[model samples]
Target: MSLSLEGKHALIAGGSGEMGYHAARALAAAGCNITLMARGSEGLTTAATRLINEVDGDVLTVTADLNNRLSIERAVDHAEESLGPIDILVHAVREDVNGYYDQLDVARLQMAAQTLLIGAANLVAAVVPPMQEAGDGRVMFVIGQDAIRGRPLGLGTCALQHGLLGLMRGLAREVAESGVAVNAVVAGLVDTDRLSVEIDQIVAHTRRDRSAVKSDLANGNAQRRLIQPSEIGATLVWLAQDEAKGLCGQAMVIDGGELG
Candidate 1:
């Protein structure tokens, strides 16, 4: 199916980060007016400027901490005021709390859940009313492979990510007839700047060589290589298009064959 987002407005949370930045760029290129939301204004400004230089469309940056409901609401209001009602919502915000169950503190676990699951729910709630009234919208959560296949080291993150899947499924069923489609993309090890830093930390903690760590991760996937952030971004752009209306309550995994 042809994927086109002409005249669409998209709001991407965590849009200052690696995967989020690429996703925003792809959506903007696909003809969607983009509003990128993040916690810090510095990264948001840089990302927005880069996207504007690359895509011939409207781009706005909003800074909001998802941990606070008031902040999220204010950011959504600012985005709506600047770029009309958001026709597509991409919840890419995630707290990077990588640790074994024993190492994870209660506070960190709660933060992960709040950022990954609760924050996404809040964003959806803010946008869905208008979308339902208009009779059209798309919401997607950018998840991780651990959401499906739990890893011991990813306990907190996995729990939150899987919870997001359930959230999407329930919301999708609730809004299907209203022309709102909710889904998720479960991504694997991607070669993004964020991933690189995460991998470095993992290697240091595990006491493994960088090359060996990379190889071990690659071996889990059929492609035997790290996925590109741009690839994930492209898939999200396709999912946001009108032609993907039939795809709802689905978790599309782009991990090569890792989860298979």
Candidate 2:
């Protein structure tokens, strides 16, 4: 029941996005210092400013490219220097490249993989080792449902998610005894700004009403509504707790029973 992360420092990669922002808010509210990292300086600044007002802990923003290992390293170094060692790492970076498996653009898929999978590897290489050395830490990957079930339009994302799931499992086993837990949150149809944009795109292409398109997405889940961002945020907070060590390498599905 004690989920107080009072002295913990968490680095949320891709922290500018809706999902990441809410996760940072939750972690900060639980008394953890937060470092928001993303490629866009503007979004980082805006997110940090808002978080500073809403949360009790300190918020730092680092503008870095996920695809670049050096950039990730620099960001991590700066965050550790400013807020101490990162006791929790939340990987929520999303690449918007999608195509059918049969007609996939190899180049685009490769690029997406570089950012989502390789970038995650780079982050883990930099962050997890330290946690293992210290013998305490948590890593959570916020990914999509395509990882568990193939989506025809999300070939690239599906590939990346599967790869990330593998990475999480392998790393969890490698570091389990060291007191570091690695897991993933498989999200589905979450109510986010990105989802809204996606819905708009579908409406424009299919000539459907905006409400109809949104309703279709929401209806994909049994709850008949989009998953709230706060729900995902709360789940991340729980997984970050010391007591959740038993959840090693598991993919916690938070899709309102959509997968069912």
* Shift of residue 53 alpha carbon in model 2, Å: 1.3
lDDT of 1 by residue, 33-129 (tens): 9999998999999999999999888999998877677888898899999989999898887666678778887797787787777777777777788
TM-scores, each model vs. reference: 0.94, 0.94
Q: How well does candidate 1 match the true structure, expressed as C-alpha RMSD? A: 1.6
Please provide, for model 2 over 44-140, each residue's C-alpha lDDT reduced to its tens digit, 9 standing for 90 to 100: 8889999998889889899887778888889899999999999999999887666556867888888888888888889899898899999899999
Instruction: Give per-residue lDDT, candidate 2, residue 237.
Output: 95
Top-lDDT candidate index: 2
